[model samples]
Target: MHVPDGFIDAPVSVAAGVVAAGAVAVSLRGARRELGGERAGPIGGERTAPLAGLVAAFVFAVQMLNFPVAAGTSGHLLGGALAAILVGPYTGVLCVSVVLLMQGVLFADGGLTALGVNIVLMGIVTVLVAWGVFRGLTALLPRTRRSVVVASFVAALLSVPASAAAFVLLYALGGVTEVPLGSVLAAMVGVHVLIGIGEALITALTVSAVLAVRPDLVYGARGLAAPLKLRVGGELVDAPAAEPAPAPARSPRRVWIGGLVASLVLAGFVSFYASANPDGLERVASDKGFDKSVEEHHTADSPLADYGVADITNARLSGGLAGVIGVGATVVVGTGVFYAVRRRRTGSGDGAGSTGGGDRDTAGSSA
Candidate 1:
């Protein structure tokens, strides 16, 4: 959930900011490793860059449409497990960070003063918990496609409550208002449990879709397969067998366009059907008296507040336009950041006594 300003004290917020910065820093380096090696290809890079942006925009849109879970309480996409499953964990952290940044600066969904705390609670903690659980389950469970799906479900389910617990712990340490610790803990955990189910389902479905299409691209699926071997004349061969030809690399433009269109439809159209209830954090805050201290966001007058166009009067058209714009902006910003990271990595590779390229040439002739 997006924590607003004044919920936590100044020192706690600053500490969270420091943690957020470190998380982002670590993510940048991890993203480099995750993007490097055999996985490093032009098309894969193209796909990942825009995919990261789409993730940020998608999470942003989904967060706006809260579905009612109980009286005065609702749930939305926390997006930790979804991003980690679809992309690598490091990139997932960046994706959530981007969404948080946009929400604070553009839409006023979260507070500017408490930005770091929000990122720490929502971005770093969620990603860490989800990834940790996912990895643990995968290791223990039977190695199969079904195991991956189940792991995704468990990981996502656990992440939400884990985040809520973290919030309670933070509040205990530095809450501005004096509230009963037991009440805060119980309330946060209870509501977020419902929210976690929604998170699990969404994460499972998204991971399944990606696995079906490109299991190779899923970091969790890496090395799960036995080495490819084929029988010839009743004897097994040591050499790996070639599979059917791979489909041609689809243009990045097509994938980007399709993702943008899907995001717009979900945010602009389906969002209209979303339950009109305060999300889990809001409900809990109101019930727990935490809402009393919240300061009005500085960007309350932002044109895109509540996900509508600045001047457009048509409800459908305004929201649709806003979704499209958000998708475009996220893609541009995300792509720029990743490209810089990739370029820097490439330069580092070259400076270390070789060409900037990462791999050693195995080909006998130039293509």
Candidate 2:
């Protein structure tokens, strides 16, 4: 959730800023590995990098559709599950970061001052929890395509509440208001549980659909292959062999474009149906009396407030235009970040290869 300013005290917010910065630093390095070398490169380049932007836009759109969970509380797509499924973990973090930044600047959805905290809670925490649980479940279950989907469901389901708990801890440590800690914790975790179910279902379905079409594109599905079998005395005997690498599927450019279109349509057309109720966090804040100190967004007058163009009388057209602009902005920012990471990875790989080659040549000459 996009935590506005004053929800958390200044000192904790600044601490979160440091944590967020550190996480991004780690993600950049991790992304280089995920996107680097011949092992994962080709896919990382045409598919992963471009699709990263699309993931951000998709996350942005999905977030707008906050489904009601309780009478006063609702939940929206956190994008952590979706992003991790579509892209590698490191890039997934970056994707959400892009969305958060855009929301803060363009829509004034979250406070710029609290950007770091939002990133840590929503971006880093979600990715870590989702990926960790997804991997653990897949490893323990029967190795089948269905296992991946199931793992996705469980992982996503757990991630939301985990994030809520994180926020609760932060507030407990540095809450600005004197709200009852127990009440805040219970309310947040309780409603977010329902939202987590929605998150799990959405993550499972989306991940499964993509896996069916292009399993190669999924980072978590890498190296998962059906077990080998052999005929022995007219009966099949189980044997194990390294799984053959998957072939490249459709060009990433195509996937990226298609995903962007889907995101635009969803935000532009479908988001109007999103629940009007406050999300789980907002509801908790309001009910718990912590919402009183909440300040107005600095960009409240932005043209895209509530996702519509300024001075546009036509609700449908204005909202649509705003959605499209958001998608475009997110894509531009996300792609730029990923492209730079890809280049750095490429450069590092080239340097390593050259060093190895030079060492070999020197040894040969001496011999």
Candidate 3:
């Protein structure tokens, strides 16, 4: 849920800003490893950085398609689990953070003053929790594609409510209104539970789809399904490891193009059918009487405010154009950020001598 300005006091917001900044800084360093630097070996090393950018744009586009949850309430994809499953957790945090920033600055969907709160809840908390749950479940369950898909669902399902709980904790700390803490917690958790189901389905389906085509690109699915074993004379022995084959040059390119197309279709047209009702957080805030504390977004007059073009007369066209622009902008900005991170990592590794190969191997194995 996008927290508007004035919901939390200035001091708490600034504190959250510091926390968000620190998390982002940590994530950037971690992302250098996840993006695989300039190494050229692992199943998807060269592709991870570009794919991470596409993942961010895709998340931005999908967040526009809010589906109906309970009556008069809607919820959209949070993208943390999906991104973490596809890319890595550190990059997933960056992906959601990019989306939140775009939403706040361009669409005015979330408030500028509350940007830190949104990043903490939707970016850091969701990514960390979902990644933890996904890793735990994947470790416990069978190492199969189905297991990965199942884990993705459960991870996504739990992440939403965890984010809600985090928000509740924040509100308790710096809430501007007088609502009872217990009521707010209960309502936030209850509604987000329903929202989480929708999130799980979206995450599972997307992960499944990607795994079907390019399982190597799925960060969570790596090293899953242990190497086969064979029986020789008497006892069973592990099968000989396959020789490492160079990755095809065009595979990731095709996947990237396909993903971009899907994002365009979803945001440019499909979003028009999204439910018009208030989303889970908005509904919960209204029901609990705390919504009255929300202040108007300072960027309310922007050309793309509220996901619509400022001068377009047709509702459908205006929103669709804005969605397309958002996707384009996010992809451009995200790609630049990720590529820069990757390059920095590459430059550092290059300066460090021959040890770069071992480090690349380690990063690939972990990724």
Off by over 4 Å in 1: 40-47, 227-256, 350-367
lDDT of each: 0.77, 0.80, 0.87
Error of 1 at 95 (Å): 0.6
Put down candidate 3 lDDT per residue, 31-143, tens digits, no spaces. Answer: 87778643222544555667888999999999999999888999998898898778888888999999899899999988899999999999998999999999999999988
| Residue clash pairs of candidate 1 | none
User: TM per model?
Assistant: 0.87, 0.91, 0.93
Model 2, residue 343: distance off in Å is 0.7
- Candidate 1 lDDT over 1-367, as tens digits, reads 8889989999998898998999999988777655543453334443466666676777776776678878867899888787876667888898889888887877778898889988888888899999999999988887777889999999999999999999888888778999898988898899999999998988788778767766665667665665555699998776656784755655556545666777777776777678778888888889888899999898888998767788889987887777666666766777677766655555565234435353431111111
TM-score of 2: 0.91
Off by over 4 Å in 3: 37-46, 231-237, 240-250, 350-367
Clashing pairs in 2: none
Model 1 scores a TM of 0.87
Worst 10 residues of 2 by lDDT: 358-367
Residue 204 shift from truth in candidate 1, angstroms: 0.5
Best by TM-score: 3
Measured with C-alpha atoms, the lDDT of residue 298 in candidate 3 is 94
